[model samples]
Target: MAEAIFWVSFAFVFYTFAGYPLLLMVWRRLARKPVKRGFWQPSVSIVIAAHNEAMHIETKIRNCLELDYPCHKLEIILSLDGSTDGTEEIARQFESAMVRVIPSLVHEGKAAALNRGVAAANNKVVVFCDARQRIHPHALRQLITNFSDSTVGAVSGELILVETESSDDDTSAPMGLYWRYEKWMRGMESDIHSTAGATGALYAIRRELFRPLPEDTILDDVLVPMRIVMERKRVIFDPRALAYDKVACCAEIEFRRKVRTLSGNYQLLVQAPELLLPWRNPIFVQFVSHKLARLLTPYFLGALFVSNCFLLRGFYLIPFALQFAWYALALAGWLAPERQQGQLASRTAMVGKSREFS
Candidate 1:
């Protein structure tokens, strides 16, 4: 019984951290192909849902205005959801004939706010971006370029964590480290098949493919792209198009964000059961590696510890020793929280941060 449990635990970790990445590399190599270019420019509506984002609204609007796409071909839609502050007023200042502001009397969550923006959008493609994030000058052009392929239903841009100009030595330590690893993983996933989820910070989809999400939906980003996948269209990730955003001010704030995300992940599993079944999805490799492995991480970790505890007898000591080493590392992370800024420390911090945010 102990041996069985040990093997099972080992397999879970091995598959998640090692096996999955190797599979992605092989798949990506086999799937590599050159992209065809054309003059398939489609009208795009860029939507931003602002909830008390007064400080960033002006800059975000300016960024949208500066996009490389044709002015007549692009429409900017900013939605202020229940802003008691100057969020609406700030947004209004940026509103020109090209930029429109949709104000909600009461604050609805992000999903509802985005839905309102979608209704007001007058374009063939709708691009969703966070009010707090800044897009590269060519982001919209790069994203829209993918639509040249009719099979591409959605396109997600790379999320780049911008380091604050003022850093007290460890300033880029947290956000920089986290995003680097995330970018690496995303690149691997993009090479293999469709990415599991789109970065909510910057993603675009065909306006015809827009679906209204539940009002309380926590992960609008995941749901939007998953909906496109459900329609049998590929959701491609374009690294060339990037969105930059600041990291949370503190670990606690970051934790709350992660908790909400993790809860949404759970909700996704309940909402999309077919994604869990390998036989039903041809891109089973993506579903299992990107989503399932993440959802099962906590449970897998616990099972490993418990199984190791029971394997104290002969030869079981090896796995038990390894388990202890992992725990020691976790403990060290807790003790010297500042160490969490480095690459290894940041990855550990991210796991803890996710749990706290959830």
Candidate 2:
């Protein structure tokens, strides 16, 4: 039973990170449904959700105004959620007929703000963007171009992490590697069926398919697109539609952000219980294999370590020794000098990225 528990936990962790992606690659190669890309123009609404982003609101508006899409077809909505800072004022300063400012009287979080902005959208194609990132001029055109395909319901753009010379090497290095790996996985998922979720920084979806997310919902990016997938419509990841954001210089901030996102995964499962039922959800296999399995990984890892301790005798001895050595090296890497530590993290991240994309 001890060995059984150890093996089960190990298998869970391995399957979640490594096995599922390998399976996706094989399946995608066997059956690929590529999006039909063309030069198509559709009425699009650009929704910006800002909370106390007074500094970037005006600049974000300017960036939106300069997008390569037709000015007549493009509408920009700046959704401000109880921002005490001059975010609303800055957005209103645009005073352009193309830009509309929606200010929520209270701090209702991002989901509510998005719901309000999306509700007021005049166009069928709703493109969600954040205040911090500057999207490429042609990104809007590239993203909406996917919708020219009748089967496509949503599309996500690639977000490039812009790192400056003065950026923190420790966090930015690993993050850059991870982001590349993430983009590759998303592209693969899109090719196979639909992306697991859309990127919040830059993603477009059909207005008619837009279900109002719960007020308390986090990870709107994942929830919205996954819901689209539930409707048996494709959600694609378009690398050509690129946007840029500064990498988080501090690990703590990134960690907190990830924690919130992970928690939202759990929230999503609760809010959309039907997604777990294979009969109800078209992408149930991918949803569980990719999303839910990852959420349970930490517990699987803990179980593997604990069970290994109990089964250290006989045949388990070799495996136990290997695990001990691995942990020891990991600890040593963390304790090494800053430069060496950063290098270790970068190497590990790149190795994972290479394996995923290879």
Candidate 3:
């Protein structure tokens, strides 16, 4: 039983990180269908959900106004969910015929604000974004073009992490690497059938398909797209539709963000249990293999370590030693602040140089 538990743990960890991507690659090769793209201009309602974003709300409104899509075809909605920090005032400054400000006096959370925005939206295609990120000028156009394909119900934009002085520091570079890996996997998943979820930074969905989420839904980004996927519609990733945001300022902020996200995954299962039912959710295998398996990885990792220690005999001895060395290296790396600081600087320089040429 100990041996069996150890292997299950080991296999789960491997499958979550390595095997899923490999399987996606094979699936894409076998079933990839290119989304029909063209110069199609559709009316879009860009919804910006703001809380206490007084600092960035004005800039975000300006960014929306500057998008390359036709002014007549675009409607910008700033949904302010009780901001004492003058976020609503900042948003109101930009309200006009095309721009609308929907403000609530009480803090009702993002999902509630989004539902209100969707209700206020005049167009069928509603693009959701946050106040913190700047969408690229052509992102709206690129996102809308995906709708030319009838199969696609939503298109998620690429979110590029802009390196800042604070974000380029040691504790955040790994987050950047992880995000890049995630984008690559999302692209693969899109090529095969659909992306499992949409990036909250920038994503567009059909307004008619929009379901009002619970007031406290933490992963609106994930839940919204997955709900569309459940209805046999494709949720695709479009790399050309780009947005930029600074990475979480520090490790603590990033940790909190991740905790909220992981907790939302659990919340999603509770809110939409049918997602795990294979017949109901078309991408059930992908959902379980990609999203749910990741939630189990930490436990699997812990179980592997604990189970391996009890079987330190013959080949088990080698496995135990290797696991010890692997963890030791991770601990050493975590402890070496100076080394990581230098590496961060080097990485920033490399990224800057690459961006200059690209």
- Give the residue spans of candidate 1 off by over 4 A: 33-37, 165-178, 279-282, 313-315, 337-358
- Full candidate order by lDDT, most accurate first: 3, 2, 1
Ranking by TM-score: 3, 2, 1
Better of 1 and 2 by TM-score: 2
Give per-model TM-scores.
0.87, 0.90, 0.91
lDDT tens string, model 1, 55-92? 78899999899999999888999987887668888888
**CA lDDT, every prediction?**
0.80, 0.86, 0.89
User: Candidate 2: where is the Cα deviation over 4 Å?
Assistant: 313-318, 332-358
Error of 2 at 351 (Å): 35
Model 2: lDDT equals: 0.86
Residue lDDT tens for model 2, 1-358: 8789999998998888788889888989999998888778889999998998877887888899999988999999988999887788777888677999998989999999999999989998999999989999999989988998989999999998898764677678888888887787888889988888888899999999999989999989998998998898999999999999888645545665789889999999899888889997877878888788878888988888889999978988887898889889878756768646555555666687456434
In every candidate, how many clashes are there? 6, 0, 0
